[model samples]
Target: MDSIFHEKQEGSLCAQHCLNNLLQGEYFTPVDLSSIAQQLDEEERIRMAEGGVGSEEYRTFLQQPSGNMDDSGFFSIQVISNALRVWGLELILFNKTKLSDGSGGFLH
Candidate 1:
């Protein structure tokens, strides 16, 4: 999908940006960081201090009962994959690691 990169606001809004990128051309309404934070659980809310959300916090939000993982304050590979799955979109993960021989290998 063609999407414009959104710069995060004062709070944790990485997830919002990711969602915008994923659904920019889709039929979903655009959402802001505050709105996303409002949906976060208590624990996830705490993680939204200053630096915004991290990978762990994003992951936790994805597993919430609401299943609105795209409304998290941050985004990670796992979070993005989960959000895409909710919309029937498939995501492929590629991991590149450097070997002892100074060569790169694709993991899995």
Candidate 2:
């Protein structure tokens, strides 16, 4: 299948492809990263499947902080810690605030 590389967001490329297939207006199921990687060469595969860009493991890891937890602190302590770690690595953390405004402008 044809694929394109875009900026990172919440899901892996496999995840996004699974999502995008659904966004074409159908139901989606999880994808196997290995299957997706098989379609690309090593560098493209790595670009597509990196922990931050194509982070299957990281996506599963994200649910704990945002989903299940006890005592607000029990939840938040780990969440803040992870955020700090991502921020500490400037490259891995994307600035999600930038948006394109309809009035002929971009917000940065």
Candidate 3:
């Protein structure tokens, strides 16, 4: 590898920084990730609607905040996975892979 690229941590946007640093450039911003999160939220809502929008469960889901992201800038793994998919990259689950170094990070 060449010189390491590190995006200084700002606020609670670790996912955004991680993605940019991992890609070795400022390829993603908070807005970009948030947009992806919103899309995921909509997809989830649609899936829940498939179970009947009039159902209590669906109503409850609609009333709840998005699972993909929150106001504090936190993002779910699904968001990260989707962001990486844009670059043709994949994130392998830690438990599903053998970690030779025991380091915590996406294997792929």
Candidate 4:
């Protein structure tokens, strides 16, 4: 790469900036991430409804704010993961992996 790609932090869009920086390009926008967040929200809603639309838990869940994202541009980890999925990539937690030798190989 000729130069490092740096996307300045804008508002509470740290997740969006982090994702673009990881991909080393301007490959995502707030709109893109928001769309992903919305889709996730819908999926969660459907799952909650599976327990019965009139159930108290489902109604309570509907009243709660979206866990996937917020109006202030903050997005949950799930949103970021889903965004990366579009490029056929997966997000693995560094501290969650172990090598055959029983060491934290993912950190390396």
Q: After superposing candidate 4 on the true structure, give the runs of residues whose Cα lies further than 4 Å from its correct spot.
A: 96-108
Report lDDT per candidate. Answer: 0.50, 0.35, 0.91, 0.90
Per-model TM-score, in order, reads 0.36, 0.17, 0.85, 0.86
Q: Which candidate is the best by TM-score?
A: 4
The clash count of every prediction, one per candidate, is 0, 0, 0, 0
Clashing pairs in 4: none
lDDT tens digits, residue span 1-108, model 4: 799999999899999999999999999998999899999999999999999999999999999999988999999998998999989998875665577766676633
- Residue 10 in model 3: shift from native, Å? 0.4
Which of the two, 2 or 4, has more lDDT? 4
Give the alpha carbon lDDT tens digit for every residue of 1-108 in model 1: 365655444365556555665576432223433333344444454654434556676666555654333444454445455456667987764447665555454333
The collision pairs in model 3 are none
lDDT of 3 by residue, 3-22 (tens): 99899999999999999999
**Decoy 4 TM-score against native:** 0.86
Off by over 4 Å in 2: 1-28, 32-34, 41-108
TM-score of 1: 0.36
Each prediction's Cα RMSD? 10.9, 16.0, 4.7, 3.4
Model 2: worst 10 consecutive residues (lDDT sum)? 68-77
The alpha-carbon deviation from the true structure for residue 89 of candidate 3, after best TM-score superposition, in angstroms, is: 0.4
